[model samples]
Target: MIIVDPSSGTSPDRIESFSLESDHSIIVTSLEHHVWQELEQEIVCSLKRLQCPRLLDSTVLLLHKLITNIVRTMHRHAFQQAIEDDLNIDIVSKDNVFDELLQNELNTHGDRNIEQFCRKNHFQVTLTFPEKTDTLIRIEYPESCDSSAYLDSKLAKAIGFTLLKQTDTITPAYYCATVVRDIAQHHPHLEQAGHSELLLPDDESDKVLAVFCKLNYGIIVFSSAGDILSISPAILNNLKLEISPTSAHTLTGIIPGHFYNDVLWGLALQSQGGLFENYRIRIRLPHDDSLSILFNISGYRHHDMTIHTLWQIVSLDHKATHTLAEGSILNEARVHNITRNYVPQLVEQKAREIVRLGGNALLNEECRLAVLFCDIAGFTSYVENNEKEESVIHTLNMILGRITKAVRQHAGIIDKFMGDCVMALFREPHKAILAALEIHKHSYDFNNLRMRAGKDLLLLRIGIHWGKVVIGNIGSSDRLDWTTIGDVVNTAARLEKNCCPGAILISETLYEITAHMDHPEIRFSKPFYLKLKGKRNKQAVRYVQTTSQTLLHDIFTTHHAKG
Candidate 1:
């Protein structure tokens, strides 16, 4: 089991030394110059110590396999150099300002005016790649002068799969002329080539290095059986794409081949929760297809032997089923079956039920409840000024998720989202008040982060009221909406309008529930009179501040206790 460790180093010097110290029979493959000789000796010493029998546990193979796959995918030239020099495998990109590099090059070396810039900077451009391979190509102008800007631009451009090359030849004063001249003489073929065949060596030794180098951005897929299905190096180093070992049992269709059934069984066991937590299995693939058999192996990050073993499990073509009888990989079809069989059909059934309850559920006599309302201040103006519709929506969704979770944590049911506003109701004043306070606290937390980023602040205005309200389904016969009505909701809206940003304001009725609870944590202000709309007498109201330490603790403690 020869394990490849890409993290070890890819330069030619490191790789050559690694082979020298390996079992003598393993043989010294090829040697090229990707890195200097100083670090090459260190790798040789480390390899000698590691070559002993059983020096590295079997688990290390997983990372080795992953690295091997990556090296196999590298540019042929990079592979050759590593093989020649015994290089260290460093996958991290050295250039941080790739975006700036690309942009600067674009403006300066663009086809429209490249001649002038090249002439003044003593630069020459070459485009020698065959038409079949050179789909998109550009030569950067050396006169861009700004190192950071140029580096950033180049990095950004190279982020996606791209054939990239850089040389000091662009400048008149070559930094290392002697070294460049040697490479040009010895490897004259690569000097004038673009998308050179060097990335894909035909020989076995060269091919191994080439493949590993290409593994830079690809996803290495392994089956449950610990067999490799595909190594997609193109996507390996990308920042935008996220690749991880996600469970494939939930995936649709027959699971692909080249995986392990044992690992799948292990994952299946884990999913079973407390009942099967300690379960173990010694069965092989296919023959022992009982759902009772499962495993509990550790997962690995690199392409090692363990991961290859896992690949075998997922590779089962006709293994098990969703049924408890046939311990299958609980594939997508099974998940859909369960969802369709038990879950509610909210889109079609909500209206009919709303009508059956009443004209307006919240307005019903038995529906006395507390209502909470919150609105994002300055939302309308912000939307009008910002042209980035997607960014705005993404941020809004994040805020809503946080607020919604807080409300649900306190047993509050969301009614509707009005623009950036949220309407919720609770069965008891305690839950309602707690939910409102949590919303304020979470909103403050979210806005604080936004403030640091120089983004617009999301200030939440909250209002709560508790009173007799009618709760029923309201709307036309064909489209009944479950909602609440009555003076309680109206009063809550009034309270919201009265409060400032970042404040959770509640009416007098809601506060009455906790006034005598004798919780030292609950902080409040004395009752104040407000001339509310549609009321003759000045209504007595007290605003409760959501920031009280006691109130915060009460919400967390209640939820934690239940969990």
Candidate 2:
């Protein structure tokens, strides 16, 4: 057993690379949730921006999730134990390893214990948590043929914590299991009914499934009596794209939605108890069972009146993707099993992109990548001078709306949009450089409109850098973001600061690359050296501006002038 108690100043990012397979059971504690969450978002952003999974695979991402779950769970247990001891609530969340359950002092914390118990233990007890969240995770094995043995009685009845795994493997299993005993020692309000089955709240059920689908499917929800409750935007976007070519190409137009009511209604009504168990259903309209939209629907009851359910709908192409290696059709149970494990939305989206690329987009080697960082000139002053929040939002959106279009036009990924800045990544260095030049032209168009409306001009400053940076996910669980890190990304942002209003700056490395490209739009104003802030040594840099021809072409090509 090993214990790691990090000091207050220690960065949680240091623990991001924690190994899943360990020779020793480890207890990691004391990291604050807020700090860890911040680090996680940074790592997530980097991993997504870099597309690290193509090389590092999904294991790194999964390990992140495991470590985070451990830390969060451990914290909760310790907090709960302290709370019970202090409040005298008659509630006890005992720390139970599989070996200790038979001897636990189980009482009725009621069925809530079932959830707590199932969250932490396994039947065979191949793995058990000391912190449950921190010390133990069974990544080595994810399946079990039989259920673990345990005694069920009043004195041993309370199962404190439970979290089940809904995976697609043959050996589907549970994460944690334990018994919680009420002891009837306190808290009269919680024991009014004596024992009530733990049902997930309406909002919570939707939340858990939404979290699950982040990396997985397009979900369709239906009420118990066959009413459509909700539809994900992704499905709706897919339907629109399929139904009409004249559909607007705005990125927002393609939101997920699930309109397949017949399939969902069938699943709910067929469920024995007002709830539909986890099962698979074919998505076919009344006139068309031939369409290959197969989805896995899992049903749960919110208030005994309505059945809330959703499916992991895979094929957005309106064709079937449910065939296995053996050429056999995937059954309902099998489909549900496969999708049981939570897959991040980014991962699934990336996977589909690779598929669309005909499997050649996956790259592992260091590619000469370009990082572009753009910010609104004097955003703080713009906000401070403009007292109305509405004007600030309107102007900011107007600028961002134009900037985002410019970035995508050049095949760049807007890694993230900060309050008034955006970070874009490009495999082609020139695109990043070109994107910067085009953005300034766009500013002119917006300024033209603003001048007509008697408003202040909004200027743009952009910085571009060229270097090899890794794209790797850094944080735990679903709280991940896509970003790229390294000197290149940092240097680009630094360059942006040095840029003049309505101008673009390029690092020496970027100048060397673009200097050779044949484009009349790019012009550099001789190399110079500067002792940039926080840097000890002088570095070579160059200033750049695109010609009218370039901006005009971009304007006419993509119709970027916002009306």
Candidate 3:
């Protein structure tokens, strides 16, 4: 550890004689060097034993600028003269001031750490261990009005270069700010709840932020004070342009109608083959601010569905109102029960309706990737032989609920569940692997909890594979289901069959993706070959082992206390 000593009339020669012990050690002194003319020479002499040429080069220029600015800003000449006169020193030098600043940075108060110093002083301080490529930087004043505006102006100027015409297009930076502003304004109750300020609140903000950051997702947040917070690591390995949420071409999901109408019209529309395809509707206002009644007639079958939902936003207030207004033709409908099994599908369909209303036409591109297939091992025997139907169903639901929670925590979308089997798709390979990891980890905890309750523990076998697969509407003309299909899906199921109870079996594709990820608790067995059904080549499968010390264990302790 570096020891920072505040200058208390220590001579320049004595300060120079102080030994630098460790590579991590540096003696920061606050001596007002009046006699020493060359600051670089003094630092070099002290750091001679330390073979840090790069540090010297990097710090010399930055430190010089900082020290010179500080000297000029603080009018150190007069203060130095008074101090030198009192201490009987010859003159003040640059080395003295530089050492003082460095010392101050390394100081430790009783309970106040270095972070407190940087925060209190509003400094952008970064400490790097060049050899290890490790860096820890405390960026202070991001919450301050001044710093936020400065960052915004900087980001705006950077984004301005990409935009052809300011009026025609919103730059990536501006779009990020706009989205952040919208979230903040409309969702004031949603606080910034993550390791970073830029993260948007999801169901579980911390987990979401961790997964997003790990996957190299860039985030930008807008403060209520109109300041922008953006963080993008310089080196993002294999990160694609489409992964960024702020990208103009990136797709977004939305829900337009109120709770009741949203479920009914959305479900009815999906039932009549209008979920993914374009649909038209007309909006006739019921009252000024009471509610907006709209009618959506299916485009595929021309089946009419009525929706009544409260409108919280007006056309004049929203800049993208024209987009919403142009595509949608509105009609009035009575509100009724919309809640049913297919509610989320309606929510997703409502997102499409917003696009129909003329918001930037939502992209119809299919996200193709891996899906994890999971099922409880020996579930049929347990259900038929031992447990009652209701009890078995309850246990199955509990297992599904626990697994789904883990899957969603890692940002995996649940495709569907057949009996005790779960089909979840991750559009990205990383998400798929992470979801598998979470599932395996959670299953152990769930089983342990069941064991404690004197209930037979249900073992889950998960199979994950990655490949191109179409993700869009499926099913008959009368009913549409958003799902995925491909050879990868089949392989995932086959891999699950090979998996043992309480194990996660993954295809070669999944193992490859998660090979080097830092998951200490997860143990992977050596890859084995399996002759899968209808497959010419033998498939490679590996099982993921988990224990009680997992995410599910923590969640159970935190949430299942009452139960």
The most accurate candidate by lDDT is 2
Model 3: which ten-residue window has the lowest total lDDT?
172-181
State the lDDT of candidate 2 residue by residue for 1-563, as single tens digits. 12223433443322322332343233333221112222333334334443332322232233334444444344344345444566777444444542143223122221123323333332112222222221212322223311222222221223111223434434454233322223244333434544666657997799877787775655444455454455556554533333332332321222222322433444344556545543544434323435545555565555555656554665445543444211113344577578844443334555564454234232222224688989987789778977574478887888887887888899877777789998888766778877877787788777667656755556788889887565545465657543466777788888888887677888887776656678875678799987677667776888887666345334432332332
Model 2 weakest lDDT span, ten residues long: 154-163
Assess every candidate by TM-score: 0.35, 0.39, 0.39
* Tens digits of lDDT, candidate 1, 340-450: 533323222433433432222322122346788888766787787664743788878888888788888987777777779877877556777677767767876675576
Instruction: Show model 3 residue runs off by greater than 4 Å.
Output: 1-341, 344-368, 386-390, 452-454, 546-563
**lDDT for every model?**
0.45, 0.51, 0.46
- lDDT of the structure predicted as candidate 1: 0.45
lDDT of 2: 0.51
- Which candidate do you rate higher for TM-score, 1 or 3? 3
